[model samples]
Target: MFGIKKFFSKEDPQQTEIIKLLNSYRSAIFPIGVQNEWISSIEKCKSQYRILITLPFAAHSQQKQLEQYLLKNKIKEVAIAIETSIPASYKFKEIKHIVLIASGKGGVGKSTTAVNLALALEQEGAKVGLLDADIYGPSIPSLLGLVDEQPTAKDDKTLNPMQKYGLNTMSIGYLVPAENATVWRGPMASQALNQLLNETDWGELDYLIVDMPPGTGDIQLTMTQKLPASGAVIVTTPQDLALADAQKGIAMFAQVNLPIIGLIENMSYFNCQHCGEKNALFGADGGSELAARHGVPLLAEIPLDIQIREESEKGENLIAQGIKVAEHYVYCAQLLSSMLHLQSAEASSVEITFSDD
Candidate 1:
């Protein structure tokens, strides 16, 4: 802190000269042969200290003037002479519908709903992609059985998405073994996520379901602002303990101006697989009451089915299991499709229900 406070102890005329020179060329000239190709370009002329730059139309004459001044003031090794120019594109349009599946707290089956809903949407013949934005705990690879595979990139950048269950999937888990990544700070986690969103090959998708990292913090703040999230689905259980956290999560999204597509109360009631009698394990209709109070729909109240757990654990096709759980997920997907108006005349309409399975 001391060093930072006193970094510029005093100014020397020659030192001032160097800074002035670099400052003039900082935006005007760039290192020739730089790896990043998105912005302006610079190329070092053979056998000359002077660098050539393709001037951006932003201020061609101004950039050229600055570059010339730097070359004239070149003190050899102190600063390398380079060139500059605008080459189009410093901004791009973002994806259309990014559905963020989030929870105020973990262990409420948030990721489970995200993964299955993504697949369920895909099953309805919509182009879907899944992004495991859960930097701290990425479970898509494990749940979807993509643990062994890694996402391959074209060239040194631009990753090709990994495919599973008719959905294009990419996760930090696919980049490395699950739970192997160290605790990432806010900035580091954000940087990794930026790479996933900007650099990866998401292509075109009807829905890009982002499995948000639990807790409303830096990650949530970044995604809600940076990504074009159409709406969010908050997953929660009926337990009063979890409800508090879920409310906080909903508030965070609302603060960022994202729509609440409704709430899915997972494990709302437990069904005895043997007895076939339903029991309110946590408390019935708690999520519905919460949704109504918040003015958001109680989209679905999913039962605590053993088959749901078994399928997730075994990495089996969940839809293959004929049950109300599968239908509920499919129904949620249809609701999302309707929200986004993804049902096109060109695309065949597929009826998704329990009986279809």
Candidate 2:
């Protein structure tokens, strides 16, 4: 069997150069903390070398760039394998990362972004889950076309997550009637969210996206402080009011010491289908400005497209339908996952201890 150690031991200059090149190559999309040990193994097969690399998150989008980079270096007959794994941490063992999708207020398409981003991550070859934490207004059931479906009990204490589009999902809407409004107080809503989160039998997942109810209120604070979330992604529009609320959301996360992964600006603009011109319906670059001000990456700027609204209304996934705008969601998922991986890497380097003085 061929291995990195043995390949280096053989003293083959060509093989050594290949390994050196791979170690030195940095993915443009990957965060700064990426290490060279990502190259898991290397083997010679039929005059071509097959290289297997492991990462903390799925990055299918960077495969082509990596291949092109290697090709440019005259490493023509090289095969690449990209695999992802959960980082070692005290965070949920079963779930690698719990990402909160939040907004300052409702109507910024937070739920839609959550659902589509979950699907996009799955599309990028990661095991993903979606948990609709919106107790007052759960839209994931409607968004995933599972409004009428209920999750089955795995045992007396746990309920199996409903599966759709290859995603493990659970929502409050699945347990309660869709039309009935949840008239519970903040603590009660927070308790229900806790129950839904703890009682669901979500199998090992690369990412579990929680579509949080709009705002930076009690429920949001409860989730941030309690859950072992890896990070958060704030969703907003280009409008001033939404941007203001987004700042509040960012501030709230900072107060709780939770990492803000990035921001997604939905309904950023509209494109005239007939004239092929772009229009800033809400406002121009508000999301970008907000992200820049907060020192967070602007993950994506989703346009105000009729197709997105219509498909979401019909409980359809744009990525499933191969819509053009689906690319934006995929890009967001890729960048978000990369950020989470980087954040985890950073966390793993730090050491914390507790002592009763």
Among these predictions, the greatest TM-score belongs to 2
TM-score of each: 0.68, 0.90
Roughly what TM-score does model 2 have, to 2 decimal places?
Answer: 0.90
Stretches of candidate 1 exceeding 4 Å from the true structure? 1-94, 340-357
Error of 1 at 44 (Å): 72
Quantify all predictions' global Cα lDDT against the true fold: 0.67, 0.83
Worst ten-residue run, lDDT, model 2? 348-357
The pairs that clash in candidate 2 are none
What's the residue-level lDDT of 100 in candidate 1? Answer: 85
lDDT of 2 by residue, 203-292 (tens): 888888999989998778887787789889999998899999999999999999899999999998888989979999888989989999
